[model samples]
Target: MATTLDISTTYYKSPLGLLRIGGTDTYISEISFIDHLEEGEYQANSLKGPVTPIVIQCIEQLIQYFQGQRRFFEFPVFQEGTEFQQRVWNELTAIPFGKTISYLDLSRRLGDTKAIRAAAAANGRNNIAIVVPCHRVIGSKRDLVGYAGGLWRKKWLLDHETKIQYGVQTLF
Candidate 1:
């Protein structure tokens, strides 16, 4: 006999875009942006096999985040990655909600400034989006760069966080 994991998925319409949320009953596994919601997809409100509590919580937190009423998330997330990638993703969580860290800085934090490219690669491979917060990483020169969700969305997220944290908008 083989064991199987029961995963529940739901969709959330966020201010940034449509998000596909997936998870087991205990922990959220993924929250990636999608260009469109596929037909017959289970939305947050749909009764689909007793929707996971964590998934609902994720959607609620995301909603609060977009509304600027929440800064940090409380739901647990589980992403599968290599040991190095795990380290990089873990470090990303430490980045303050509205603060940005350069790839060089992230690499240095990982104990090797030479691993900048590796760090950036790990950041890019992150499956969970806002909660893991890959958008907080930037270029060493403070330039906006490399976002799987698109640079425009990255810029918007940065500006939104800045406005919420500092009462002013960021130009970059």
Candidate 2:
């Protein structure tokens, strides 16, 4: 028999707005903004399982991240995806917090220059978001595109990180 899992959901306010953090017993499963998922909708789906201590740690790390006090996150996350996606997310985390890389560059780094679209798709499906750092991936032409959190939020995040990297005041 397959192992059954129970998931937990919690809402927290962040600079991006209200966010719904979801987790299974051992790892964080999702982190979606309220505006994107709406309230009570995901709750109806019955999260895959209960929140574990590691999941709680991920939540706390996210809290620190949004406060601009954390430059990197170290937390366990469980994402469901194909091998390609897993590879893409893994490479995404390797990107430093305040830097940007192009999708074509990522595709090349993956040793397949033609896999840009696949790379973008993998980035779009990233469940762990900021922790995975998929936002660091941009268009080959240095344009921001295809963010699950919306382009505006992507720009905000990049700009914020850039400001933080330069030690400048981050203000819209």
Candidate 3:
């Protein structure tokens, strides 16, 4: 018989919007913003099962991050993707906090300047949002573009990080 994986979900009311955090008892599987809680979904801190430690840690880290008290996350996150997508996500993590990288630059870093579109596609498919820092990727012209969470929220997140890192209000 095959054992089943129990996936637990919880909500977080972030400054930007509502975020849904999902994970197993061992590792976090998803943390993405939700416009609103769906019916039957647990509210913030009202988790049903034994809450995963990593999920709680992700929430704490996110709180600290919004408060400008955390620069790096220590929680472990897992996302299912192709090897190429995995490579793209891994490169995204290397992008320093409060900094931005262009899709072209990202492709070059991946050792394929022609793979810009592929890299950007992988970025859009990233399941883990802020933790993976997909918002940090910008267009080649230094303009904000292609954020799955909406351009306004992307700008807000970049501005937030800039203020936290440079003590300035905004970068753009």
Candidate 4:
């Protein structure tokens, strides 16, 4: 018997936008802010089910993040990519809350300053949005750069986190 992979999906209505989360029960595979999920992911897989435990956990943590009650995510995220891309994602998690780092600096930390462009490319390919903290990355000049979810969303996330960390409230 050929067994199909067990994958599930759920929609999270976040302050930013509608998020489509897809993955297995044990780990989150892809989290996109857009309503549409790419092909061959949990959404397109043969076996579809209700939201898994990990997906529920991810949504809960995301709520906490937006509510300013959480700075780090603990859910297990399942992502398959090149080794360099994996390393880039791992480094993104280490970026402090409300803090931003440049792609050049990130590549430097990875021990290859010449790989800055490659690092940026990997950052753009990140599947897990807020959980992986890809929005925390910026241009070398401290300007906002590439973001799959859109530049406005990136700015909003930064502003939201910075405001909460600094203990300020705005009428947004």
Model 1, range 19-102, lDDT digits (tens) per residue?
Answer: 878887788888888875456654443343457888889999999999999999998888888999999999999999789999
Question: What's model 2's TM-score?
Answer: 0.85
Q: Native-vs-model 3 lDDT?
A: 0.87
Please list all clashing residue pairs in model 1, or write none if there are none. none
Model 3 lDDT-worst window of ten: 1-10
RMSD of 1: 2.8
Indicate the TM-score of model 3.
0.92
Candidate 2 lDDT, 138-162, residue by residue in tens: 8867888889888888888888887
- In model 2, where do residues sit more than 4 Å from their true spots? 1-5, 36-51, 169-172
Model 4 segments more than 4 A misplaced: 1-4, 35-47, 168-172
Cα error, residue 52 of model 1, in Å, equals: 0.5
Estimated TM-score for each candidate: 0.90, 0.85, 0.92, 0.87
Model 2, poorest ten-residue lDDT window? Answer: 1-10
Question: Which order, best to worst by lDDT?
Answer: 3, 1, 4, 2
Compared with the true structure, all predictions reach lDDT values of 0.87, 0.78, 0.87, 0.84
- lDDT tens readout by residue for model 4, 1-172: 1123576867778999878778786788888987464674534542367778888898899999999999988888868889999999999989998888999989997899999999999999999999899999988778888999999999899988889888655212
Instruction: Output the TM-score of candidate 4.
Output: 0.87
Name the better of 1 and 3 by TM-score: 3
lDDT of 3 by residue, 107-132 (tens): 99999999999999999999999999
